[model samples]
Target: MHLLIDQGNSRTKACLYKEGVFTDVVLSELTPTDWLSIKQGLIGSVAAAEQQQQLQSLLPASLAVRWLRSTAQAFGISNSYQQPEKLGVDRWLAILGAAALYPNQSLLVIDAGTAVTMDWLSADGVHAGGWILAGLHTQQRILVSATAQVEAAALSLHPLQPGTSTTAAVAEGAKAAVLGAVQQAIQLRRIERVVLTGGDGAFIQQQLNNNAVLLEPKLIFYGLARFIDNN
Candidate 1:
């Protein structure tokens, strides 16, 4: 069995794979106890050592673990970025999955979690770099938290129409800004195969009309699994 772990800023995702296929998946708060439970029955695990000590304490001493890092190995894709190591592993894995799934097609992978990241990979297997921006909730919360004038009610994503009140207006505006930024990234890349994943992926996809492919949030885990399989 192979275990894939994605330790993101907000949550930790785990997937158990057997015989080259994913058998089960789970998401948990990045807590010591939760980590320990998920590590049981896994032969090996892969993740970034963001909280290395805490993670080490949770796993059995015999378990083999690997940390993901960007490299020049070119997993069937050409990384055009000047510094491949500077790319985030999460984004790298996501694009890898995109390339593997949609081979011979240009792709735009958008991850809308704590932050929105849009990465481009060409059909010829080239990593064309990407852009990052604040997510909808992140932007709204930052504005409200940084300023005393804004209220929490003003950031709700209710009714799709234009806001009738000041609070609604603020919330709607924030959402629009996030969507606009994502749209602009997709447009600038000019890639039709846009894959959306992350916390707000569904919402973002909805706002994007039919311009993108909405993928499950576990796309990164699948990518990591593919990497392990190929290696």
Candidate 2:
């Protein structure tokens, strides 16, 4: 059994895996006490370097823990980054899951969390790289910062239409920025599918007009699971 943790920007999620699947999942903050309580078990974390180091220090000296990273190549997919280490483990693992789950499919993997990322992978297993942008809340925050009038808390996931108020305007603008990028990518290529995941993945998917898009919130964990299986 292994304790798998993905310490993302906004929150930390941990899960238990045995054999090749997740037996349990616990989403919470990654704290000193949390990692300290695990007296025994193989632990793995895909997180920022600092958080990983802090947690490693709190673990029992005899226990085993490994920090996951993106290598030059693993699990059949080639990383597009010239320096593979510079690429994010979360994105790399998600690519692994996408390749494993949808073989020979051209895809655009969009993760919309604290930030919005769109990665393109060709049908023949080539990672064409990706783009990153401000997340919905982040966009609203930026707007609020730039102008003193509107409140950041006013934004919401309203329908994608003309903005009737300040809140609607900010919310729609943030969503449009993300969707516009995805739509442009879809228009530019013969993308077979768009796999949306992350904190606001479902909300973004709902506003999209295309049937090719899907919301798979647990995609990151599934990708992590693939990495663990190969090890």
Candidate 3:
């Protein structure tokens, strides 16, 4: 079995894949200690350096862990960044995942987590760059923090229509901002397919109300596996 670890800002997702399919999945604040049954794995992380070190220290010495990073070019994907490594590993992996999942199609890949990110990949495998913005909760939190009078409770729903109350306004406005950004990105390029991943991906897609939008929650894991197989 191969363990695929996607360690993000708030949580760590671990999956066991064998024969091109995931057999088990776990989500936790830190890597679970009970994964000793696996012998090899790939880690695609956006956590702090210190945190990553802690993760490495906790892994079994017998387990082989390959850390995935961004590059100028890999597997026919040409990164557009002037300094490719400066790109976030998660975004790069998502782009790789999108390309591998839907080959020969212009794709706009969106990962909506603590922060919402959108990356574009051409059918020819060119990284057309992307945008990053505060996520739904982050936007609401910022508004609450930045202003004194905007007191509101946690949002129960996100409505595209104008909100009738303070809480609704805050919640809906954040959703509007994210949806607007997605629409803008789609207009900026000839996106043939729109793939959504991350925690808030489904929410974004639902708000957009587009049946064409795809939710691929396992995109990063697929990218990790593809990168490992190629290299």
Candidate 4:
């Protein structure tokens, strides 16, 4: 079985893929012990070393372990960015997965998690670059931090129409800013297909125009797996 590990800022996701289909999935906070436990059955694995050393150690010596590094190697995508390697692996993987699923079509990928990332890749397999912005909670914290007197309240996913109070205004503003940033990216890139992923994808998807595809959260994982398979 192939183990795919995605170590992000908040959590680590591990998935077992047998043949070409995922068989098991696990999500846990970044902890060495947790990873080691999950590594027991993994024959081969891929991850960022700094975030996956424990898991790597648990694997058999014969098992292959590959670390994902930012690279300029064309994953069949034309990169329009001035510094393509400077892009995050998560973003690259997302775009790669999007392209693999919808090749030769202008596409936009929006991942709404701790941070919202909007990336664009041409159908012709070119990375046209993208943008990133703070998530709802992050944006709320920024507002409260910037203004000591303003109190930030919990953000609700209720469709925002108008703010009824100051706290609601802050929540609405945060949502609007994030959604607006994503919408702007889509417009600027002239993307034809929009794929939404991440924890808050559904919430953000609801706020967006009905032109986006709500993809499985494992879109990046699928992309990474495809990258490994092809390379």
Candidate 5:
């Protein structure tokens, strides 16, 4: 079994993959103890370069690690970024994963975890670029920190109707900011499907009403596998 790991801002998803198939998936916060105990025997692993370095430093010296990277074009998708390498590997992998899942289909891939990110992929596999906005928790913290009197609000999807309480108002604002972005992206292009992932993906999908949606939290790993295949 090959060790597969994807490290994100808050946690890392680890699993065993043999011949592109994953088994025994695990999720753990990026704690020292967590990294120190990774199973040593595995064919190899893939992750962001910086993350890979950090992971390797905590593993056996001979462990094989492959850094996931962004390319100008792959899996039929042409990246529109002027400097494709500047694009986040997570975003790049998400785009690759989306195109592979729905070839020839227009998509707005939204990952709403640490930050809310959306990448548009044309029907013919051209990445039209993407946007980054504060995620639910991030946005709430920003709002509360900026306004001394504003307190952190509980996350509950409330109606768009006017909020009567201070906490409710803040909650409503954060909801609007995120939900609005998702709605706008759906209407911005002839998006055939909205690919949602991340912590808030299900909430976004619930609010989307009548739109096709796919929730795959492990998209980056799948893309890593595909990228390894074609490159």
Candidate 6:
């Protein structure tokens, strides 16, 4: 059994996989009991140093842990960044998952977490680079912080209609930004597959209303499994 941990800016996911298929998943830090019988583990983290160490301490000494980092190339995916190591590991791993899930098809992999990241991967396993933007909540927070007039409000998911009030306008604007980014990305490239992952992926898919778009929240794990296989 292998434990795959994807530690994001706002959340951490620990999954138990047997033979490359995950059997269990936890959103918070795993207990020592959770590590029982696990022999090997892999962690891909973009969290703070303290958070990383907190999780690291929870693992059993007997378990061999591998910290996954961005590289120039791996698992057939060629990263396009000039400094490949600077590429976010979460995005890198998600691209690996997208490549394996939809082989030979150009893809737009969107990970909508604390920040929204959209990475384009070619059919031939080449990463053509991607975009990063303030996420839905991040946009809202910025609007409130930067402007004195904008106030925080609980906004629910609604159709993209013109807003009548200040709160409504703020809500609609944030969502529109995400939609606009997606539209611009697709128009710039030929995306054969659109895969959405992360916390707000469902919202993007719902707004897209495209039956072809796939929602795979566990995409990072798939990438981790592929990485393990290559090793």
Q: For candidate 1, give the lDDT of residue 171.
A: 77
TM-score-better candidate, 1 vs 2: 2
Report the C-alpha lDDT of model 6 over 115-195, residue by residue, as the tens digit.
Answer: 999999999999999999999889999999999888765656676888788988888888899989988998899989899
Each model's RMSD to truth, in Å?
4.3, 3.6, 2.5, 4.5, 4.5, 1.8
Better of 1 and 4 by TM-score: 1
Residue pairs in collision within model 4: 77-125, 78-125, 78-126, 78-127, 104-123, 105-123
Q: Once model 3 is optimally superposed onto the true structure by TM-score, how far is the C-alpha of residue 181 displaced, in angstroms?
A: 0.6
Q: Write the per-residue lDDT of candidate 1 for residues 6-117, one digit (tens) a residue.
A: 7777666667765567644543333455345443332222244556556556555655677676665456886666787777778887887777777889888888888889
Preferred candidate (TM-score higher): 2 or 6 = 6
Could you tell me the lDDT of residue 33 within candidate 5? 58
Q: In model 6, which range of ten residues has the least summed lDDT? A: 23-32
List the candidate 1 regions with Cα displacement exceeding 4 Å: 24-50, 153-160, 229-231
| lDDT digits (tens) for residues 15-131 of candidate 2 | 766666665555344355645554334333445679766666645565556667788887668899999988877787777777777889999888888888888989988899888
TM-score of each: 0.83, 0.84, 0.91, 0.81, 0.84, 0.93
Clashes of 3: 0
Checking candidate 1 for backbone clashes, the offending pairs are none
- Alpha-carbon error at 111 in model 4, in Å? 1.3
Per-candidate local distance difference test: 0.70, 0.74, 0.85, 0.71, 0.74, 0.87
Clashing pairs in 5: none
State model 4's lDDT.
0.71
